[model samples]
Target: MKLLSTPTRRIVAISFFCMLAFQATYFVGVIGCATYTLGADAAGVSALVFLLNVVLVAGNLASGPLIDSAGPRRTLLAVCAATSVLGLAVWLAPVSYPGLVAAAMALGFSFGMSTTAIDAYPRYFSEDAGELARMNSLNQVATGASVVVGPALAGWVTTWAPVQCVFAILALAPLPAVALVWATREELTAARGEGAGCGAGAPGAGGEAPTQDAVPGLFVEGDATPAPDGRAGVRGFLSDAAEGVRLVFGRSELRVLFFIGFLGFFVYGAFDSLESLFYRDVLRVGADWMGWLSAASGVGVVVGSLLVLRIPKQRLSTRLLAAILALVGVGSMIYTGTPIVAVAAVGQVICGIGFGALAPVRTTLTQQRCEPGNVGRVSSVMRMGMNSAGTLPLLVSPALAAAFGPQAVLFGASTLAALIGLAFALRGDE
Candidate 1:
């Protein structure tokens, strides 16, 4: 049966592959660079991850206005082109630590922009809750597929070829997306027009209007005033960004969603510092195993995404979200609690399922609850919350990992996440 319309399918396909390309480059570059260029130094790897996330936070802050002003089509085209160029530069240039760091920053920013654009696409294409849920599920499928292939591909490639070649291949990956997005220009423009009138406060949109204090002067009375012109300078941009932040926190539902997402990612921060080392030190395996285990997790994510599709739309509730969060934490504990490679892979899959299921639920809730006109900005605020949460724990994770072995540190974090998820689930917060 045809689930999504032709245009929607095309858009989903483009987003899927584009995100795959970007994620592949990221995984390959980070793993290859860490293993080969940085000589497997944990501290150096931590620094790279920290810097990349810092730039990503900046990119998320800027992308909301770009999406709201220029539209997702334009934003996608620009970021994809920039990513391809950055990849080409890294491929051709000398492989110095400094060069890699610069490339990582560029990639991080482009990634942040592209992610916000992609997330906002569903809001533009349709307003139906079921359709939005389907779109988000498909998007999460793309993420899962990328997670499966990218790291595994990285691991396999690093086993034989020079790390430089991976970047060369990455240079070609986003080119297809550029062409695809350009072809959809007219469709996207029309969709954007339709979406603007479907905001929560619109006559038939079926939601209470946001409070005056939600965005102060920006959404004066019940109308969403157009943001100041894009060329209106930094003050205008900051105003737009601040509006997005306020819009998210002003609503009780959005605020709760943001907190849930933040907690999930905050728990993930430790993995940046300790995951690879877990493979080497705990699993007592080569770096290649990390890719394979990650792929296993990706497979689990695929399963989880499929499960979401089968769920009754009504069942996709906050309680389900809480359950999935707890599931993920349990999986993480299983993943890190064991020293055996086979056992770790099992844990990865279990953990992957929770993550896979979690994305669509959170995204669908955010999309459904927010005003359509401000979807892009709202999504960016959500992204910023998660990214910042993910980034902050990095500051202390390495120290924790060092003091207590990587496995123990990871285990403790997982336990904490599980406890939090369970608490929330039992409380049944709406």
Candidate 2:
């Protein structure tokens, strides 16, 4: 059955594998060590997550130019291979402090690069906004599905088999992504030289010749001029990165989106970091109920993503984003307002759906606004904002919760989200 198109199948399969691998590694790293008494604890756990966040931010910064220079497919394949190798290493190495730290570094860098590259891969298939939205929604669905299943699967494997076996299985998940990406090498080559196909003077996929005006990024999109010496050295890389940062800040629209993304990830990171505490201490949820509570958001993500297909394509606008943001804020507030476990669960579901719907819309807008040539770089910048926002919050969330209480911190996060969403809604496109 040809229910899915070739490109769609490839993108979905790769996205699924990446999400599954990421979730498995993350949960295993956090929960596996403690559940099995392998040495890492609540304190040590923070170190691992902190290491991952640091590497993720660095990777996002480096990945933008790398994707533009190396092309998205190649970058995707490389990251997948690296992730698989790291997963295996995590399993094979002695579960010691040093070993786990090394695994964290490798895994974090690989996962970071994987995410940055995957967002750009869809461009190889379609440039249309609707098509991109649908594709992004599918990718979000993959992530939601994996989030629902990955932890459960990891727990089951850790219970029945040894932790090593669980790691080994997670390692294999990226192998399929590697193969799928390698198969599309030809497509990647074509996409890399997209300008050539438009002929000498025809417009690019962005609907006009890429110009230096209205854009100032690490790499100029339509410059036919080849790189000096055919390679950007370390200095060049840094310079390009600086320019990309400038471009993002110079544009008002990009700046607003970046701020919203930061707030989104900041809230998510804070909530996720305090999730176990809230459920265990406040709601008194058991391990079984905890899993269900966690999966509720994932279920909502799937349900909300499906709604994208039904929405009138033209109606997906800045206003849609505002609505989604407000919904997420409201959901989070409701979730944190009560000590009742069931009510919190409902809040999680609502928040998940809102975030899920926003994912595709945000991606579409980012892709639409940025020139095709620099989409990867712009996306990486966006990731940088989101990733960076999460890092500090994650580190502080536990301590903050201890002082202010989980409910209070969570309520503040919701208020922040609501205010940001309101700004976007009221400001309109400048």
Candidate 3:
């Protein structure tokens, strides 16, 4: 049998290339702009990262409702257009620190929205636990493939051209996704149908959905009160957003999953602040090595995600997720704990496996626990937690790196992550 249907394959394709564009433009472009423009100043880079995360938080908050109200396809089309426009504008404008900062904010917000839409798309396709797991793993494979290719492409571009030029090329990256999504719009939207919204007691294999009494403001399908005016519309949106938050935090299973994701991304936030510095100062490597190492990690992600595909459906669990988290932490510790470039490359591969495996597992768990009507909002809530966790440490990472050195600070962070993972593993079922 074919592993995925024709429409499902198209969805996967749209997700892959759109994320590839995002990875190249925002992930690499922001850092490259900071490094080349700011002379690799730690403070400047941290500020840029911090700004991106802040805007990302806001975007995610807004996107959940947009996706739920407007539908994921439309929301994705709008963000893809926004990304393209922002990239072209940044490319045309004379390169300056201020210009880069503005571009970062716009791009960061778009990226945040795109992330929510992409992740929530799987639920729109299937409610079956095994199918959801398979789709999520494939989606992660797309992400891993993008990670492998996007940075390497950016690294190559920087060799012969200025880093600013990467944005110009990235301007066209989302155009294909726009065309593809628009073409497949009706079929994809139709798939959402009546089953998209789940009522109370309709949880997936992971655990029970929040009861009506437990989640006071949960958005029940067919129960929405019509708004009389524009002001009511605004209030309605806020109410929906608030309901999403309550749904996530109010459920016991979701709460544990939320904190697990928060801890994982907390480690990544520190990486955002100090990882490039670690490359330049600690390993004494050229900028290209950063791209190469990221690509290595991407390879590991592919391997780990593929591994997830081979596991029996009966074996998927929160305990397994905790073990994967611990593995990721150990890989990160190895990556940062040593001075040898080869050893670090190995560590990147190991760490990448953890990240790759982590997404499918976490997403499966969240989908299993979430109501269909609130999928977009619930996904956004989880993103908000992860992004908020990521944003918080940036405020102090520069100082911590300065006082303790980047290598030492990073190693400590990794160690803490491993211990948290182990602790969660010991706690048993969600």
Q: TM-score per candidate, in order?
A: 0.73, 0.68, 0.74
Residues 107-134, candidate 3: write the lDDT tens digits.
8788889889877766665556787778
Residue pairs with backbone atoms closer than 3 Å in model 2 (clashes): none
Candidate 1 residue lDDT tens string, 1-430: 1543365675677676676666666655765567555666566667778988889868878998888777778899888888888888888888877887888788888888888888886665555678878977677666667778877776676677766666755677788778777765533455334334557754467965444343322222344544467566667778889999999899877887888788788877878767877776777766556567878888998888778888887887777788888998999999999898887888899998988788779899889888799999999999888878888877887778778877898999899889888887887756
Cα deviation at 399, candidate 2, in Å, is 3.3
The per-residue C-alpha lDDT of model 1 at residue 275 equals 82
Query: Clash totals for all models, in order?
Result: 0, 0, 0
Query: What lDDT is reached at residue 329 by model 1?
Result: 93
RMSD after CA superposition, every candidate: 7.6, 7.1, 7.9
Prediction 1 TM-score vs. true: 0.73
lDDT of 2 by residue, 307-377 (tens): 87688877777767776888888888888878998898899899988887887787787887788877877
Candidate 1, residue 257: how far the Cα is off, in Å: 6.0
Q: Kindly state the number of residue pairs that clash in model 2.
A: 0
Q: Give the alpha-carbon lDDT of every model.
A: 0.76, 0.71, 0.79
